[model samples]
Target: MDLAARSPAYEGLAIELAVEDEGWHDAGLGDLEAFARRFVEAAARRAGVPDDVETELSVTLTGDAAVQALNAEWRNKDRPTNVLSFPIRQLQPGERPGPLLGDLVLARETVEREAAAEDKRFADHAGHLLVHGMLHLLGHDHIDDETADAMEALEIEALADLGIADPYADAPEHL
Candidate 1:
């Protein structure tokens, strides 16, 4: 069965956490609910989500099977990715967000594998992913070189604020 938690706004954003896979509960991540709240809220602030918008969003921690299904249905990938963001509506940068933002779904196995491969602490990697997903929910994309650079910069700044190492530090610089 899924375990869920919902609390009042954290600086104008209400974040709900739902653990859909037992592995998440057993992952020894230390308070996934609080982690999600803190990272997403910080991301919203960093991405200029507007403190007065009174937004709401959900994060689901699940396994690859579920994520694969979602990916196939929504994105037609037929594979499990680390995280997926499903936004209620796409907003332009600087556009005021709304009461309902979007949902972020993460796969536990994929996240763990990625963390181990990248030599990152699981929590730090997950936190970075949360920030990335939050940016996507706010309509930030890396579709073009310029936009990718801007989004990556915002992600680095946001993750730094949360005390996470820059996820793209080792990535080759854009030409």
Candidate 2:
């Protein structure tokens, strides 16, 4: 697709997608922009963001190699992950942010493999990850048990809005 094929804006946030992997073309995931907006709005609402939260969230669809390189460079992990969220800046309480909401990088291969292994539809898993990533961009984290619980619950709520089942409901041990 070319520049003219860019998706329309959702709510006050503009979703820009960059598909770098050929495999993504045939992934059967439909209307990614709409999905991103749906989850993002839900996440922002859960985060207490106002209805007029204007921002641009760039969603890059790439492969495991790209994600692994980023993981290694930024998180010091030499492994491929499903998604990475890079928030542009941290906003203080009662503070407004700039137009950019940072970026979300997704590994198509890793996400596909995980969905298959977990007996989930790829789109559903992607929704979960997308919400998780957006939450991260909104300054949510899972660094500790308490924080993890809150974040996971928020993820579950967002997924529910997308009509996806609770991801952790069927999660295997050691996840």
Which candidate's TM-score is highest? 1
Indicate the residue-level lDDT of 61 in model 1.
Answer: 97
**Cα lDDT tens digits for candidate 2, 69-149:** 999999999999999999899754234546998899999999999999999999888878888888888888877888788
**lDDT for model 1:** 0.85
For candidate 2, give the lDDT: 0.81
TM-scores of the models, in the given order? 0.90, 0.86
Candidate 2 Cα errors over 4 Å, as ranges? 1-10, 91-96, 172-175
Error of 1 at 147 (Å): 0.8
- The positional error of residue 11 in candidate 1, measured at the CA in angstroms, is 3.4
lDDT string for model 1 (73-162, tens) is 999899999999999999887777788889999999999998898788898888888988999998888889989998888889988897
In order, candidate lDDTs are 0.85, 0.81
| Model 1 per-residue lDDT at 10 | 52
